[model samples]
Target: MIVHFQDKTVDEQSRTSDLPIHIRSIKDFRKQKDYESSLSDRKKSKLDINKKKLKNNSSAKINKKIHKVQVYNKASDANFLFAVLETIDFNSHRPSNNYRYPQCVFRFATIIAIIAGRYAYEFLRMNLRFLLPTIQTIENNWSYQPYKEANFRFEETQTYLSSNNCQYVFVSEDCSAIIPRIEYDASLDIFNGFVTPVVEGLPTENAFRCTTIQQLKNLFETNAYANLVNIHVAQPIADSNNALVLPTTVLAAYGTDHKLTAIDILKRWLIIYKKFYSRGIRVLGFSTDGDPKFLRAMRLAANFFVRTQILNIYNNTLAFKVKIPSNWMSWFFLGSTQLFLFVQDGVHLCTKLRNRMLSKSAELTMGSYEISMEHLHDLIRSTNKLDHNLSISDLNVKDKQNFASCQKISDDKVLNLLLLNDKYRGTYNYLLILNLLITAYTEKAIALSDRIYCASIVLFYVRLWRIWLHIERSPRKNTLSEKSKNKKKDQSPHFITSNALLCIELNAHYLIYVYLLIEQNVLPQSIAESTYLFSSQPCENIFRNARALSGVYSTRINFTIMQFLKRLNKLNALTELKHFEETNTEQKIVFPVHHKIKRFMDKKQSNNNNTKLTSFNTHDLEKIILHAYEIAQNMANFVDLSNSLIKNNMFNIEQSSKIAKQLLHLNCLTESEIVDVDGSTDDEESSDDEDLDTYNKELADIMCDGDFSEDELNTSNSFENLQGTTYSGVSE
Candidate 1:
């Protein structure tokens, strides 16, 4: 105990200092030094080491306290600092740059970050803690890829199409106005913005080829965004439950100032058609907004209905075919082909109808029939235009695509009010045409018989309507309403806006198409197969999305074509990623759009239990057509050529009666002489191709509408089934 005498003063001073809990035993050991000597020789040695080895020495232990802390990387840690700073798992040090995220994870992160912007992307990245790729990484991955116009992405496109075995497709084209600006595409090495000449459906790459500055200057001076005529592919899938279809943009070419002619359109269509045909995909139809040129093209192609072959008997059976029945069935196919139907956009039809309804110059009056805007004005004044959707703002002439306005005016509620007095039977007949047609196209494709019940009357009603509104009519001055602001320009019906001709053409061609399809056995006559599903809706959605991605203000809608192209890849990337992430069984679309207005509805197979299903009468479609016209004529006997609004009736009522029997229009059976109608020039129907998602809701609904159980189909044995009335030309 006296061994520390020499250093006693120093030890005493050092003892006052605080020591770690682990070394506290040493403090007691200093004070009780004699206790170590009292222990055995072995115990004394053990005490100096792990004191537990010494007997009765449990107190001489080291209490090492272990602290628990949570650690998080920098990126994720920053985001939570605002609200959860105390609880967040923040990393004390920066993470290693060597970590590589999985391909899918980074791609998802990149899409989210990019949409928000570079600044937002960085901010997100800090919160994601290196889970997202850097902004530079995404930029590098998306480095300049030129969109080859008319250069179909055969390899890339066939990816989903082949998977779903999609066979039928429609080629839809519409022009969206673009910002007229000249820009050099480095890849194509040509000035873009001038209308590119389309040769065989392919944009001529060298149209603006220039090495000199003067040529470039000239190109710019004449530059127009050239009306971005985007050509997209719409595949109307037969039946995949409630699967959706995404539009595939195959060609993006600008147009010349003048719209393409029927000949040009056909040539381009045939070229594009062949490309798909070679790929084992069959094109069923073409769709567009109501452009006169397109209407002309469709009429030219519809020549298929008139060109028929005589049925020859051989050995009490069908004879061997000689002429190309295939070409006759189609507008003009090089070989065997399907029917080439033309579908106008339904939304456009509604708009066109609205335009006519609000036309200031012309009044909807011919003979005893009348449906004028003045009538609407009377109704509006009565109701104060407050209790209904109709309003004065709906008549803005500049807004041609005003579907909302059209719907409001065409609303059943508004029409019921118009017919409140029951004095406007003819007016109601004319007003309901567009609605019936639209509901037929966009909803379920009811039986031809059912559709005809509503459509045929409307078809004949237009014949009378057109005869009265035609610009060539005599005594047009006094016939014009007294309220006309101008006599000539205002009273005279505008060619496109009149829609009297358009209505006739649509219903007539629809009859012809139904007749031809029923005869061909391609469509199930027992039920109406509304398989015509391709529309410019896909193209419109593309424009809508382009606007959204640009983050532009609502007012400034114009943008360069290149800017539009750049957004496509990014969109495609995000879409592809979304598809991979979600459980989607939809065909045609690699990626679906997230649109607000798109409604998802469950397709219910209509109950045939309540209604007796009638057998499709495939025998006499001409008879059916005549009946439709006859029915309309019977309903309204006001249409007499001699007593017409025009006073130049040279023929008697006898000739007019003969024309009515044939179910022909007034143009052919004119008073001077009966003119032969060119079957090719006949018209067809329209589609309200809204968003693809909106379309999906009704897809299976329409698909199964025509599809009935075996028992339902056998309910009635019609002449069409028993007599086998399928066209010999189409069958051959």
Candidate 2:
């Protein structure tokens, strides 16, 4: 058994006499003996062993904690804070001397941070703590300053990331304006002594508005800001002797003094133009009108900034020649082309106004300015090709003579001269003449003679005669055979014959003349009458020559006439002629057949009542009588047939007339009926009511002929056929 005690004694001498013994006083034990040394030596060894075990355990614990921390940090940490920090440095502050920033990577990171941090700021803020170590490390190693200014600088940096240099200066000025508001007294009275009794007085308020131009200049001079270019200062034209007359109220507000100041500013800025251009900067200046002073200022500025004799000369020349700048000229040219192609001139301005209202710069009305610019651009671009440079004074003696001689000339030279008149007055007049011709035709008011004359002239001009002559020549090659053999698959057949060309030309001439007549309201009423006189000739003669030439049938001619009639009827203009009075005052002309027929019918009736004559005379009379009877029978049969078809609604009036005429040509009607006065029937001699009814019944039977059964045939056809066949067919 082991025991631990403050001192070790030789009471164990009874068991081990030779063991070392140490004695000491309880209070001064270390001074008493070597026992203190032995105990100290043993305690030092045990302490060394415990110290070694503790060091190992602590190291293991620290390693485990570090590993857990690393896992947590890896899971939650974001690079967004570093991105923000880098963006601030890149945009707000210039880079340090030692640290070379990766520009593209910085730009990419800045964009991502701005976009991603939009709704994830809490996550970003939490992870920002992790970046503090990195920041501190950077500060220690590279002497970097992260938070030298207030956090607002970071905010400002973000705000100005995508903003222009001018926008940043404006933002600062806006901030300065708000700062004054915080110090202003809201309750201060405006009217100190008089206003309380008479009316309610408002508090005096002083609102601070920053002068941005001055503030921006101060910022640029004081701070290491990015280069600013194309700074525009619009000074109003004032009611002063030096001020140029401007077109707007805003321009009038800035005094002439301010305009002078602006000119000076422009001149100074121009001096830096070359410097700016070298560093990728562009500068521009614009004003409402082409002011001489402004142009002078631009010239001076260009000379100062560009720093070259050639550029100065170019600038001076451009300022003098082009009242507006080239950018505006290009804009005008392109815009005008678009406008001309899509919009008619008169309506274009109104369309532009509507479009301008919806644009971002709605307050500005620059449409007319744009149009002028476009015109200038067009003039500039076309000057070389079209020789638009030729002025009125440039006309030679021959040109003047040609122009003067156009009045009496009808040659191609005159036509070309008129077309090149530049004023377009002659073209307008010629178009008007064409319009008059068109108006006259459609109104159908020109005389047929006049129409024919105009048509002949039109055909000559349109080359219809030449086209006809060409058509008279036959094809040189067999196109059909070649096509069938498939020698050339891409080859098309030539189908445009000379006749077809002539017809087309004729049709065009007719259309043009018609257009002129209608458009000019020049149609004369006598035109229709003349046309009718020419057209009313017997169809046989009128179409005979045409049909023989064209190999067209009479039926086609009739069809064409019918179509023309239909078209005329549908035209309301021709309907007015339906009520036209026809007056024929000439004496009635009689035909020789009329007198013979009248005498024969009268003599025959008289002879029927006389006594029987000699055999030879009786035979002759019988023969004539039989011939007359045969003719009467044939006429009756024709009339019966016509009446039959008409009664059954199978024939119209025109058809019946045609049938009656055919019968007459066959010598079907007897002299008595044929000689009936002025084609009138005798009241008593004509078929009586009973006879007419009998005739109609027989006619109906004949009309039905083979189609009707025995029961279907009426008395008209049966009786007529029975009576006519015996007299006409048998006797003849």
Candidate 3:
């Protein structure tokens, strides 16, 4: 476990993803040392001594020598080096000289060994100094049972969490079972106390059920074989800050194959929440991923109180009956203290949306107006010179210029096909559009407000689609106005086509809903500003770290507990290191371990620690606010945005004609790419069909019914339109 200086604290959260740090593998280091020491030769020498003693046992002096040699060999076999080897069964099934491990297997084993070796070496080093007493040490000193310390620590952590008023905890649960290979007699038969087993490595009819740890011990010669389900907790220390603290408390653990239901999971969750809530700690929500069964259970648990007062406060009912995948959730869960929000991870949503687009199952959104996989393939082929003579031809000047731009970008390699997955090509095209939008903000070419406005509009479009899909799945009919007096003759380049215009209008309608939500202050500041809070990636990240630290040598449950504690310690240490860098903490603690200390951990200890104080920057907040206000300008008057969208779609010809007159001489068609309108040969048709088939192939079979109705215009009246007017249209 890592130690943090007591006097320091974390002040803020960072926006950037944490860099993954790689520590040297201790197992490999130990293996190298063992190889150098020639343990194999020592084992052979010991065997030779045994043989000699058996031959010369006739003499008393030789008998004494034999006894001493036997004792030494037994002790050597039980030492750390051989014990480590035994853990892996390496020598038991030595590989032939010609047999070599696959590159992946070797790499994985090396990594695992490194981690295990680090923990083992650290434990030994600390134990030798009598400084850091582990559970084993405590158990040795006390008369408690196996799980007593764990239980006590869990209760202690709950008390601390209550005092801190920590809420919005992220929970992750996973199950690990005893592997069949690890069980010594996986195929063994047993007839209980009355009969001898006939076969080895084969189970008898009576041995079907795993009743106790004693059964595992009988099978594996050790009590380490057991299945377990573990639950972990992570909570934010401050709502205004992004610093999350991982507590070393296993909220609940069940024996493997325990018939635990969603209610069981919820009961445990509520127990933790209520403990804190009763003490004034307000838990707002939970974030978890993986295990659809468990998530479904959680959904059931959340649905139990759907009609509760907290949930009823909102005008619209939030349903929780949707299929719970890794990232997407159907509804919010309600609790006593706060309305619990279920997050569908944004990163995964992006991937899903991209995939939907690639498969052409994408509900024909703004980004997919004219882009297709054929275009992407053509660009790739042209750029790679596979079709060096490919050129834009046989088109009008407007079409030719548009094709030329596409050709130029293709030739310039703006999209790298080699770096992208074929299955995610559609997702790629959408991100290409996002890349442009993000670039506009990052480069400061567009105001942060404009970028955020665009992002919000995009999100509103997505949310609107979700709402429609959730409630019903049918396209709405919108009568095309043949004699409208206020429609734009030529729409902006971005919405040049009818479909693009319609999608944008539908999006604008939903933007009103989002504006109302902002007015209500229902969203977390992070979500309201950047709209990127819909990610469970952080929890996923924590799970990843947990898995990496849980070495293969120990029982999964024990290792998981150890790994979680170590992670909590590491995070605490990191927090203190940052705090100490800012302030002069006179009191400090030092811990020496085998793993190379990080630079921050190795900072010089002194009254004034000489490290420069780096003040936390909140410039992102300024950018977010700037973007929010910019979007609020047009969104404030939903009528103006509605008018622009309507005119662009030719729903109001008079307004459209006035805009068209202003751009009468401008090159409107120059920006629109021409599709395969040119006459195609039989070969070209075949090629196009083959490419289309690739795009049509679905990576995942589960496709949501994406059909939605957004043509209705009456929904906007219910939402309040803020007052602001920086009148401008969508970008070309």
- The prediction achieving the highest TM-score against the true structure is 1
Q: Stretches of candidate 2 above 4 Å error?
A: 1-45, 57-281, 284-732
| The 10-residue segment with the lowest total lDDT in model 3 | 706-715
TM-score of each: 0.63, 0.17, 0.37
lDDT of 3 by residue, 1-732 (tens): 123432222211121123232323454577788897898789899999998886676587778778767755764652433333333343336433222232222222222223344356356535433222332322232221122112213333444454434443433344443222221212232211211121211112233235677864564552232344243443333342323222222333322343444434444454444444433444444544324444433433433222211112221222112111221111111222223434333333233323333443333323213334455455545565453333433112233213233333333244565224454343343444444323322222233234445644443333332222212222334212221222442222222222222222222222222233334454333222222222344444444544444434544533322233233333332232322222222222122333422332243232124534322123442344335334433331221233334333422323332333222212111111111111111222133332110001123232111100110001110011111211100000
Alpha-carbon shift of residue 197 in model 2 (angstroms)? 41
In TM-score terms, candidate 2 sits at: 0.17
Give the number of the best model, judged by lDDT. 1
Model 2: per-residue Cα lDDT over 33-112, one tens digit each: 57778888899999999999899889999998897667556533334333434444453444333343332222232222
Root-mean-square deviation (CA) per prediction: 15.9, 50.5, 31.1
TM-score of 3: 0.37
| Each model's total of backbone clashes | 7, 30, 23
Model 1, global lDDT = 0.47
Query: In candidate 1, how many Å is residue 52 off?
Result: 21
